[model samples]
Each structure stands twice: as structure tokens, then as C-alpha cells.
Target: MIKKEDDFFSDMYQSINRAFADVIKEFGGFEISKKGFGFNPNFDIKEAEHDYVIKAELSGMDEKDVEISVEENLLKISGEKKEEISDKKGKYHVSERKFGSFERSFTLPPEIDSSKIKASFSKGVLSIHLPKNEKANTKKIEIKTE
Candidate 1:
């Protein structure tokens, strides 16, 4: 029941959608590593008695481009990196660093207080501090009933 005009418009819609996605990539902030590229975000995730800490090296990303979210026990980090110069034209000598959308995640412990987590971005690094819940911080002592 689809008409030719409807099909044409649908194709247009898809094209426009792709353009918008490009715009998002340009300004949306960090680029996740492309498939088959052996590069990762390069982060350090560590656990302490209180909570877990994550440090990520996002060298070229601004504050607005990175997105961090925690759902249940999963912590997600996503962002885009805007290439310094896009006017490649025809002059290219060396291209090494990869650029695009990137995402990383860690499995957080159940005791983490996601709501109270603190994040600070400086230079090209993003440091996050997650504090444990009060109950998780205290040691439990079992009492024997005689």
C-alpha cells in the first residue's frame, strides 16, 4: 500500500537522519573506537574498601562531549572526539590516531553510591570517585546466642 512518493520521502528521511548523525559525531564529544581497530579508551579501574575509582584518559575531549551514566551495577562512559582539522582536502602525510565515537563500561559493585559519585575533568583526564554506601563501609560482627 506504499506509494512511490512515500518511498522517496522515506529515503530522504533516512539521508537526513544520517546527516544528523554526522552532526552529532562532530559535536557530540568523544568517538568510540571503530570496529577492528585495536584501540580502546585506556582506562584504569580499581577497587578499594570504600568504593571503586575509574580514571580515563580522554586527551582531546571537552567537558560537554562526554557522557557518564550508571544503571544498577553497570557504569557506562560514552563520548565523541572532534578532529582538530577536518579540511584534509588532498594533503595527507600521516594519519595515526583514530577518531570517532567511543564507549566504555565497568561492572560496579553493589555497594557503590552512584548518586554521590564525584567526577572531575581536567587537562585531558577524567577522574571519577564513587563512594560506598554506609552499610558497606562498616564491618559486621556476628554475636553468638548461648
Candidate 2:
């Protein structure tokens, strides 16, 4: 009798799980994976009087692992986070950390002087300073009425 009850509950649980996955697929047009996703860092952009500052939070990453470049008006940031090897004898009950390569790009304004841009990394945070061209700064014009 106990075996029959266990089988019934197991069947019900699998049916419910399939129904949930079907609903998610119907709405999102994609199936959820059990593996996991890549590591994408969060960023913040701030504008100052003469320059724009971009900061990216990349925890558990070294400065050498990250790369920054500019092509035309696009600024690109790419990096890889390697996973550590664990003990073969140990078993993991829950693993939630994500490790992989990620790339992010942003379009820079025409007034920005890319040649003079500067970058610094400290405490897992990367900061890029984009200075604006003085000649390209916005100017006000006075209109004469006839």
C-alpha cells in the first residue's frame, strides 16, 4: 500500500512540473534550463561637468581578466570568470554561482574624447572616465529680431 501511494505522489509531482514548464514556454517562447546562466556585471553611468564616468561591479574577478576597448563610437567591456575546481569526494547540495564570459558595449557621444579616456580598477570595481571635447560643448546663440 505504501509503494502505491509513493508512486501516485511521484506521478502527480512530475505532471505538475511539466505543466509549469509548458506555461512558461507558451508565454516566453523559451524553455528554462537547469544548468545556469552567464555572469553579467552591473554598471552605472554618471555625467559630470567635463566628463562621463562609467563604473562596473565585477566581483571575484581580477584586473587582468577584464578588457576594455573602443571602436568608432562604441565602448566595449568583456571579461571571463573561471570556475574553481572542487574536491572530488565532496558533494554539493546547492550551487548557485555563475561563471562564464560576458561582453557589454555602449555607444559613446560624439563630444567625448576617446583618445584621452582613462580607466582604473579598485576593489572589484572598474571606472572609466570619458572626457568631453571643449570645442564640442553646447553653446547658446542669441537671436536678433528684425
Per model, how many backbone clashes are there?
11, 0
lDDT of 1: 0.76
Model 2 residue runs over 4 Å out of place are 1-37, 138-146
Q: Over the stretch 23-141, how does candidate 1's per-residue lDDT look in tens digits?
A: 77999755432321222467997878888788988887887888999888888888887667777477555555655677887888888888999888999899899999989997879
Q: Where is the poorest 10-residue window by lDDT in model 2?
A: 1-10
Best by TM-score: 2
Candidate 2: residue pairs that collide: none
Which numbered prediction scores highest in lDDT against the true structure? 2
lDDT of each: 0.76, 0.82
**Model 2: per-residue lDDT, tens digit, 1-146?**
12432456546766776788899988986764322125678899999878999999888889999999999999999888888887778666656566778888899999999999999999989999999999877678999999
Among all windows of 10 consecutive residues in model 1, the one with the lowest summed lDDT is 31-40
Reference-based TM-score of each model: 0.63, 0.67
RMSD of each: 12.2, 9.6
* Model 2, TM vs. native: 0.67
